[model samples]
Target: MDKFKKIDVEQLNIVDENGTVRLKLFNNQNIPPAIIDGEDILPGHRQSDPIAGMMFYNTEGDETGGLIYGSKKDEDGNYTTSGSLTFDQYKQDQVVQMEHNEENGKKNYGFSIYDRPNTNLREDIIKDKEIRDSKKSENEKIQELNKLWEGNVRRAFMGKNGDGDVIVQLSDSKGEPRIRMVVDQYDTPRMEFLDGEGNVLYKLPPEE
Candidate 1:
């Protein structure tokens, strides 16, 4: 057994037997870009405003998911902080995540599950960048991007909102809330069932 009393490192990587990076821990300055299929996608984008965290990689060197956290305070006493743990779908974005976010005096924390399409995210990223850089109008670009990434949906969320309300929400496949249970800041508990159009079709108390 070997041990070092004091070790300081800005970045560290844990590699598998095949020399593939399985896990990486890094500081903001040393954060690595998102790597997929042995290629760095959107290089330099993450480094521009990096957060200190560790990233997980799959056997093929694709980013799986990671934990990230950071806090910053401006000179005027305003502050922002956030932390997140995520598990990504293969070749896609996060399918499950727990997150905490605070900006100024607002705070929100939640665990959520998402449904993503089978489309490869690497191709979507490249296409998104192209759409942004295209000569098309802003509205046209937005429409195209929306159509490109349509199947990404938040399926469920259970957490405290910025307004201090505890909420458990379940949505349909189209991302419409079908059920919502909440305990508001005032400690009033209520449950509601909604239609696809977001109309409250039923309530616990019958709305009497």
Candidate 2:
């Protein structure tokens, strides 16, 4: 397809909403045809090899999407790899390390996902206290503001830092009427509410 090389975890896109996760797999390399061995590679590959370098997008919470590298099986094909990489042993060889970026305000949280077999790494995100605290605080503030509106509201992004502000976005119940709420270092938000046409509706008073 593109140029064959080690997987770039950044390019993979996974969007998940509710309990359903939408996974779109596109490789720069032509998926290696099929590994040979006695290999019904596709079938066995899906069961054993961990889908390497995957990005996760969690629409529901903090554990949205990121790069997946390590040992994993498509036991139920939740990831849709059954037809591509089929067996367990093939999956073993497929394991890889992945890098992920979690957006926070104007900054991003960067980390890696490692293969468990022979790859020892910390599994929890909280290991980075500063990043974890920022995400949690950001989520809470956004949730509070979400309850103020009657329509659909969402936290568009959360990054490490920038202009010393935290940004939260709101959309209509059906996800329109886009608005941005930027929280300052003191946790006060300077509001910029806009309509579907991107027109500013009005600005609210800063939080005291």
**TM-scores, each model vs. reference:** 0.91, 0.27
Q: Which candidate is the best by TM-score?
A: 1
**Model 2 misplaced regions, further than 4 Å:** 1-106, 109-155, 158-162, 172-177, 185-188, 206-208
Q: Per-residue lDDT of 1-208 in model 1, one digit per residue for the tens?
A: 9999997999999999999999999999998888877878767866855379999999998999999989888799988989999999998989999999999979999999999999888999999999999999999999999999898999999999989999999999888999999999999999999999999999996886
lDDT of 1: 0.92
Best by lDDT: 1
Tens-place lDDT per residue, model 2, 35-109, is 232233333332334344432322322222323333223466333221122111122222222222222223332
Give model 1's TM-score versus the native structure: 0.91
